[model samples]
Target chain A: MKFKTFAMFVGPSVFLMLLFIAFPLVSVLLNSFQVTQPVFTTQEVETCSAGFLTQNCVTEVKTIPVLDENGDTVTTTEWVGFSSYANVLGGQRFVDAITSFDLGALLRIDFWRALRFTLTFTLITLPLVLGLGLAIAVVVNNATKAIKGPVIFVSLLPFIITPVIGGLSIRWLFYGDGIVTVWLEALFNTDLSIAANGWAIEFLMMFYRVWHVAPFAFVIFYAGLQTVNQDTLESAVIDGASRWERLRYVVIPHLMPLIVFITLIHLMDAYRAFEEVIAFSSESYRITLQYLTYDYLTPDDAGNRAISSASASAMLTMVGVVILLAAPLRRTWQEHRGR
Target chain B: MSDASLPRAMRQPLSLKLASNAFLLVWLLLAAFPLVWILAMSFKSPVDAFSSSAWEVLTGPRTLSDGNGVSIVDIVLGIALAWLAIKAATKLLMPMTVAEGTLHRIFNWAVVALGFGTLFVIGFFFFLPLVAAPLEGLLGPLGQPILGITTEHYQAVWVENAFYENFRNSLIVTVGVVTVSLTVGTLAGYGLARSGSTLAFWILIIALVFRALPHSVLVAGYLPVFINSAEILSPILGENAPTLYGQPLAVIAVLVSINQPFTIWMLRSFFQNIPVDLDESARVDGCTHFQAFRWVIMPVMWPGVITTGLFSFLLAYNDFLVTSLLLDASNQTMVPAIAGYFNRETTTTDQVEAVAAAVSITAPLFLLVMIFQRQIVSGLTAGAVKG
Candidate 1:
């Protein structure tokens, strides 16, 4: 295609992306370094009240947001560099917790607590999703032809389900007096509060993620399995390789690229985990980095939002994702260059 | 391939087959049971829906006494109608519309959907009762409640709570996103695929990075701008410009941009598969570049376009963060509206209604998967396996 034609064809899409995606990214980076607040001014007010038999008058100074001519609150923006980031990092409390070597106290800080859970959640579920997906793919590959379609269809339900709905569905199964909870209580002959316990909730969140994501991995791996080299497998078998050995040597090597592909996508997605926090209602005990930004941005009862802090947290999250993608991204770049 | 055709060494042993099947059964249960359980929960009264005993939830004896029960006749007829409707929609309505060509397809789909919906409403609400009332009188004992089910929760959600407004909002956002993304994406994707410049490669890489950013980051960036949008637009629109903060339009713009990268990548891969000879040959016949693209390339691109469009639809539809944060109460989508039902304390009945609302949203998705299972599967694997 001619460069002019190419430009013409891609112009609208490029414009939309620049105006929305690229612009917001730059805005977020800048906003993290600045603070915006309603300009407040102190004013003196006098009040008169009838108290029983006497009228009392008092004067007090109050701080209020100044309103402009159009009745909108006047606001001021200033360069604050890393102050917002410091605030999000828990300024003095972070230093104290680190100096005292108190891991528990460190986690009490929202940023550290969220970072701990998000990292663990992403790393833990990566292996489970991979393992379960591979197992299902292997088993289903060997199943009779009659059952393959139904198995694939049934397996896809969790993947296709809306994330919030899927999370809520699992939550309902283990929530208070829920079916699984009731069954477990009867089996163990003890009271079991599944949702109240932090570890159990964490386990459920991981379990739900693996269950939700494994199907995606399975489908991709299953497709990879179809093109596996039968000649290599047969040659390995002729050389007296066991079933597990043949798989280890032959099948896995063929699927390595796909494993890396899935890993990259999974890491990108799981690092931004937000739905599980809401679906499980874990805000009180557990929160992810994405949710932390949302919390900062959410308006309080007084309608005050920490926009600067939210920007800082968002920047921190984007940094985390880019770090996770670094290796695979370099590999992709190299491969493209080679091509 | 069948087991008999495989060599003895390649075949699975009998014990392994049994264990594998058993494992698959367990997994299938894990994957599918929640949807089935939730579907069951949506129909029962609050007492039965949340009961400790599974059998109680299934039978709903409390619901029967509340005069909201289903006789054997109702159950049989209801299942029959549901099965028939699904069959007709998938096997008949879908292909018929596809045959109607591009411009008319949307109109045909709307007609089929609205027609089926009206039929179901008439059948379930009026026709079923009219037929069952006389039959119940004829067989006194047999007509009594065999299984308890109720539509009250569904009524509360769709009618009393006005969840249809949210559904409409969701429809507007998804439709707007899919249409705009696919339109722009196809052009950009074809352009990139045919052009082998370094700039094209660099653009794809940048898009990949953009695709990976957390949605909340973008929202935070959009938040301050949206709040001040009215003032920003006042000079342009002569002082009556509306704030974009609480509108569905804002969600659409953000979602489209978020979805564009994936859409272009998928479509570009699809376009790469089409032999360039088709369009080149058209150009050789004196057709302009745009003419060749529109007349020659687009006809073969429908499958890819539909597949990309399905994914774009899913992203817009499944989104919660952008929609919930950007849109206000009156313009909330179904997912956030359902979340609102449980965000605060509510009665048991209200909780059940929320369950009903959750189930309601899944129905359209179920139909979508049923009709386009092939497209969805291919679309997913296209990125992973082919690209």
Candidate 2:
């Protein structure tokens, strides 16, 4: 195709990406290194009628760069290098906490707290989501055909709801005197509030993440299951291989690429976990990197936002995500090239 | 223990089957029960839903209520029973072949009608009343407890909270996101398919990077532009131009960009698979480039386009991140607005209404899946595995 034809086809996307994605991307990098605040400048003015009585009556009145607040002159946006990053990432505080070896003190910082949970949530749920998805897919594939459609439909319902609503539903089930809690207490003959304890809350969130995301992997794997070479399966059966051996030797290898694909998608998504934190109301005890960025942007008293810090945090989160993505992406690229 | 088995119990080793059943059962509960529970809870009165009686809402019996100072219960039940009895009589004759004679065919049709009619009668009089009216009796309509059902919370959410406005906002924003993403992404996908330029290849790769980048990082970037949109546009539109911030248009713009990577990924191969000779021949026949594309390529691209469009619609429809952050109160979509009902600042009494709102927000999603389940299942792995 001619470049002009290409432009007609590709130009709009480039312009959109440039305007929306690329521009914001560059802005984030820039904002990470800068800060904006109300600008002000000092001006000298003569006292009302004192100038008539006394020569040389000059008093300083704070004048705003654009607008004044409470008669105090506010300044325009100013560039500050790395200060916002330091505040959010806890430059000195992080180092001090590390050297002192105090886990509680380290987690006392919002960024650290969020980072800890984000990492734990991602790493822990990755295996569970993959394992559960693969298990269900393989079993369903193995099951009698009559029950498959209903099973798939029911299994997919959790993922069908958006994560927030899914999280909320689970949250209510674990909330004060909730049915689940009520049953547990009744069965165990002891009182317990799953939502009240940090560990319990984290476990529930992890479980919810797995429940909501596993069906996606299951769909991918189930689709993959159909493509498994029946000829190879027959050979394995002739070799007197058990089901476990067939799965271990034959099925897994075929599904390897799909497993990687699911992992990549899950890693990218899990690293940015936000909706669960909001849905479960877990911010006080647990937060994720994405929610930390939101917390920064949430307007504080007097309507001042932590935009600068949010910018720094966003860029930092992107850097972390890119690192996580690099390996799987490279593998995909290599696999694509081979194909 | 040997492969031959120590006994009949151990003959073939039932462990995997047992394990599979247990595993499947656990996931079924994990995956399906919460939504079912929520649906069950949404119908209960706010008092019963949150109170210790919450469990009763599911197990308790229900009954039809009086209407306009008169009970229509007896009439409805009489009709339902008659239909059901006819259906039961037909069940015994279900094995009869319709091809045998007119009598058999009539019996078959009667069975079908009675079966369906019984269901409709029971649902209309018993279930619909529970969802749409006030109820009071010794036994609530369906032979359940007197306080088994209520429609007040659904009313509080739909009518009192004006959720329809939020629904309208979601529709507007989702439509915009779908349209813009499809249009621009399809164009770019076509380009990528035909060009084979190293530049185009790199662009696709770069877009994948953007795709994986979380929305918050991007939200941080968009904040400045939105806050200063009016300032930026004053010189261009000559003043009084509405800022893009807080507009459904802005949310759509961001969503379209955010969803483009996947769209391009989906459509590019579809575009490439089209016989290039068709486009070439059309061009050779003196068709303009754009004309050839419009006349030739688009007609053949409908299936892929439809698949891509459904996904785009879903991306915009299901998104909570960009919409939650970018849109102001009046601009909030259904997902965010549903969450807004549960904002910590809201009172405890609104909890039932919040759940009702969740049910309302999710009802369309549930319906969409039921209607288009095949398309969605196929679309989920559209990019993951190459055909």
Candidate 3:
């Protein structure tokens, strides 16, 4: 009776998720293998052929041999093997797209450059965000109510503002007519253009990303800090441990699981950096996989489907690798918690 | 602890407490600087704002140059005389402290009064330019008449001058996406929680991992599928493919895919908190599983449902990337719409208008947060701490 009741309770939800979320994903996976059918009709094809051969023949081709209701087709053809997968892997359009980018001498220089930029951006921002977030969390956690209430709200304000607003505000700060530019020009008695250089652009990008994402890390870390037993910290302090010593011996070890969780989450998010970068810079600095994918799938491009699929495939492979590496960390984490 | 043993305020070792306060102050300044600067800038005239010296900009210049190469200095001298008069008046009226008996209580009251007074004065000064300029423009004989008291900048948004259609489109898309994603997410979350097993646990983890995948990758993967199938699905949709592309459904579909994982995970956590004993008791009372869930668990999980709904709503409303990518040019969200206002060729009025639009776009989210601030903070912190 209990088993029957349990099944009934869980049934609808399980069924709906499988149908909508899981099914569409699986369908995409399957469709990626199959060559998509061309939308053009037989008469359209015959008219093109007739233009080359004989003009009068185009009119006679009204009922030009075409696919019937069943699978029989005199004109329409379906190719169904590993052809779709093979075409993607062959790097035909992929090679052309990479070579067209013309970054430097290397054959896949664009892809490599994007990869390099993404990794550096992630590395630079992740530590700063986590460090600042942890510090803010600890401070806010210990503050008096008078200070804490307002401080908590202010700390969390950036997270509430959409990234577009955050990015626009930063852009305004650095623009030629902006306050920062005006202030800098006056202070130094010289013109400075941070946007013109690659390093500065990447730095600004990282700063904006960190500004928007740090609040997330702060909230998570704050919550994790709350879970740490006060007794452990008190005991450590009574034993004559310094603040840094207590942090190292007690808090760090306790927050390790959460740190790992947030790091992995942020790493994945950073890799997919799209909107902020797009808003910050023009095409010259568009060197991320997400931008590459956007460039490929843009409506004007005819070969969008193939190149975008290849890029998506590349992203999936990278994510798979990250997950594989984190597997052991996750295992040890679960084991530690179990103990 | 002895009073002598206790560290004196002046001689106390530079403790973490002191360092933390300093650190938090710096961070708070960093966070608040742009907001305060922009608010100040909104009040300053364009010429004064572009001035080279911060001292001159913060305090009006001692002398002014007209574009015609004329100088004006008496205005500065008159302002200085007025400042002296005001200072003398303040010194005469303001008391140092109240008397010491019941006057001690009066001293505290005086301090509070002074603090509030200072805030009121500063706020009035900050907003005075924004208020006075428009009024002066309207009242002047030669100047073009304007209707509003504040800057005409906000007219673009209030009137929906540029992207009014886009604003409506965003609202429709946000509402549709939130409604669908929350409904599906809630059900999926309940399922995962009730059917607890190793496989169920693994699936939950997979959902979370999928949620963690970069939004761009998911969009990339989903685009080919959505675009190609649009024509095929058009008949079912009762519209043409292009018509559907920028419509609310497209945004809703993408949001549903992206947000389902979060909805499920949050719901599962909420469900797990419900005791198995309740389910067993329901079964013993001859209620079917569906009836037990509907009658028992659903009421208890209402808060979780609402929290999930609000989160999904905010995600949909605030999203810029997916909406920008999938939605058509005509179907811009508020974020993108306001962004477009700034990207336009800026006139003095237009620039102000852009700032107004930005403030308007963010105002709703701010109001929502203020109203449900407690629920949201708890909901956000719950996932991190409990999960």
- The lowest-lDDT stretch of 10 consecutive residues in candidate 1 chain A is A320-329
Candidate 2 CAPRI assessment class: acceptable
Off by over 4 Å in 2: A40-74, A329-339, B1-19, B52-54, B60-147, B272-289, B345-348
Question: How do the residues B257-307 of candidate 1 rate in per-residue lDDT, one tens digit apiece?
Answer: 998889889999999989999999999999988999989998889899999
What lDDT tens digits, residue by residue, belong to model 3 across residues B1-387?
A: 224743232122447668878989998877756554544434334444334455444443322232211112222333554576457435743454444543374466568556755755564545443554555466554333211123334555567576567667767877787777766666667667777555566666667666655555555555655665665677786465554446567668767777777877887787778887897799899986667777887767777776787788878877876777677676677776765666683665555566566656666676566556667777776676664
| Number of the predicted model whose lDDT against the real structure is largest | 1
Give the range where candidate 3 chain B is weakest over 10 consecutive residues by summed lDDT: B63-72
Instruction: Rate residue A96 of model 1 by lDDT.
Output: 94
Q: In order, what lDDT does every prediction score?
A: 0.89, 0.79, 0.63
lDDT (Cα, 0-100) at B328 in candidate 2:
87
DockQ for every prediction shown? 0.74, 0.47, 0.29
Off by over 4 Å in 1: A50-55, B1-3, B7-10, B83-110
Location of the lowest summed lDDT over 10 successive residues in candidate 2 chain B: B61-70
Q: List the residue pairs that clash in candidate 3.
A: none
Superposed on all Cα atoms, the candidates' RMSDs to the truth, in angstroms, are 2.0, 8.1, 10.8
Order the candidates by TM-score, highest first. Answer: 1, 2, 3
| lDDT, candidate 2, A10-82, per-residue tens | 9988888888899998888888888777766667665644356667655767674655556654545667887
What are the TM-scores, per candidate, against the unseen true structure?
0.96, 0.83, 0.73
